[model samples]
Target: MTGPETDNESPETDDEPPEHRRYARYLELLESVQEADEAGLVAAVLRDDCVAMAESAVNRHLERRAAQLLTDAHFPDWARTTAAVIGDRAFLSRRLREWTLLRAIALDEPWTAEEVTGASDWFQRTAAAAQAVSSPEALDLLAEHGRTRRVRNAATLRLRPPRRRPG
Candidate 1:
């Protein structure tokens, strides 16, 4: 009998559409979570893996929520894959941690200090924008500007050029 490892070929090649494929996987997970069977645990594990793969696909682009939904799914296997894909590591960039925090809240996952480290300067300012609001109206005004989304602390600051152009 061939063992599980016998197959030399890898699964989920680059050609697959991970986004579309994940729905079927999540359906299986939903059933298993409802049934609480050993199969369900297996389904969840597989679903998490699928979510991770899907996130990596989304991560290659500048997309936010699409990638985050994979994380917001809240499986460790999934969330671990949802972070900003920087060199050799992944995370919510300093410019984007608030979105991650808000997402964590929406998902009922609390933000951890470890995840909050290396926060971008933009994150602090955006947090303050929300914090500076004292009344509902102010928040509403900001919200009108799509400010409900995480505001950048300072990713836009620019330096002035010198007046002289040497000839």
Candidate 2:
């Protein structure tokens, strides 16, 4: 007995495809992240899935903000890279192939600000962890991590070596 569907009808109904439903959920989560205070932001990012979704979401502003939040929280380089790779899909795809190189040098788990500071080679450790991932989404995550690591390392190499201390 329902009349024609109106433009204002909620998109959350069973009529929507699974992808649309997931996207709607992502949008909701993005709003929650945007509304969160610093502590809440930290908590949200602690969930690996949340951070992973934040990286690949279509909203550039959300992606960049998520990256900034991770950086502010002192997350490892891979985490930072995850958020940094939002704009270029082809670039992200290519980076996935080189993920194995990161195996020895990255951190494989989500960390708090306190935990991240003590880790060495977070990129390599994260990459190593990523080796087990088989899905395209997981590959995207690994690719972002590798890309960030390479950029950070390159930047470091570009810096002049420290001058020798005066005798």
Candidate 3:
């Protein structure tokens, strides 16, 4: 018997929105996540195959998906909590690691060691301005382990604590 995979079929002919037609598959997956229960949503996001596909997706699709995931407060928070429990290999953790570097490429933010590995030459500059400030601990982390020499030096300069007045 011929299975659906083996059967010849034309592409989807439904009256989908024009913008979505270009990335219908990704939009469909994201729609399903919206419809899912809390547990189902987590399972879908955590799937290794889904994570891999997201990692390789073209920039437009990746940015759309990431922005949606981040904007919908519950999902990103849940992903973070889940990652804390399950470990860094969680899908969102890995995606955000890439997202950070992709974002940094545009605005001159320093790259973290874990964020810059295996990046390609093609990248979009995502930010208009550098972050106004970073926490001391965060600057310390970057000063110690930022991926480039420039990043390390810049972070070290920003790592100074606030001055105290005379007693």
Candidate 4:
């Protein structure tokens, strides 16, 4: 049974390209599917024409968006790795500036962070090895911040601080 055709009720098939770019290709492919004379194709179930194509594209876009959201929700692994590699102080500073996760982190950030941490670990291990080779001498430089000390030089032999009990 058919009546005067309307826009919404246009033949389950129409030559107009789908309204969007992504599904335009799918629509074209489906049109070819419709044209096939093989009974198998005709019977292959089109998902009810336009509705199927639109729904498929929406589902695809939603799936991709969900994956991106999930990755963002659990991005701390990269931050911790970054903290470990860049060294605690620099990592803290950079984190204060902006988290790598806050930026577009798809291609380069993760790889660069791994490399940084690897190099940092290597440097630490190397330093420990070198320190094991010989004991290094260190000097202690201390000053009494509140107390003033009289200078004892070749030109002046007098001292000003009391060496005995203050009581």
Would you estimate the TM-scores of all the predictions? 0.25, 0.24, 0.34, 0.19
Best by TM-score: 3
Task: Write one digit per residue (lDDT tens) for candidate 4, span 1-167.
Answer: 11112133245546554333325443344345321232232222223355454445433432333234323644455344324433434433343223332222322233233322233322222212322212111000001110122211210221123368778
Using TM-score, rank the candidates from best to worst.
Answer: 3, 1, 2, 4
Clashes of 4: 0
Q: Model 2 over residues 25-137: C-alpha lDDT tens digits?
A: 54555556533243333333333344344334434333344334432434444344543443244433333312322221232333232222223344334432432322333
Q: How big is the positional error of residue 24 in model 4, measured in Å on the Cα after superposition?
A: 2.9
On a 0 to 100 scale, what is the lDDT of residue 44 in model 1? Answer: 32
Q: Any runs in candidate 2 off by more than 4 Å, and if so which?
A: 1-12, 34-167
Question: What 10-residue stretch in candidate 2 is worst by lDDT?
Answer: 1-10
Runs in model 1 deviating more than 4 A are 1-62, 65-76, 82-87, 90-100, 112-118, 122-167
Report the number of the highest-lDDT candidate: 3
Write the number of the candidate with greater lDDT, choosing between 1 and 3.
3
Superposed model 3: Cα runs more than 4 Å off: 1-24, 27-51, 54-77, 80-133, 153-167
lDDT of each: 0.37, 0.37, 0.43, 0.30
- For every candidate in turn, the CA RMSD to the true structure comes to 13.6, 14.5, 10.6, 25.4
Error of 4 at 122 (Å): 42
Tens digit of per-residue lDDT, candidate 1, span 1-167: 11222223337634555444454444334333432243333333333445454334333332333343534444343333433233232432322345555345335455544333334434333433533222333223233333224432121121123378789
User: What is the lDDT, from 0 to 100, of the residue 86 in candidate 2?
Assistant: 33
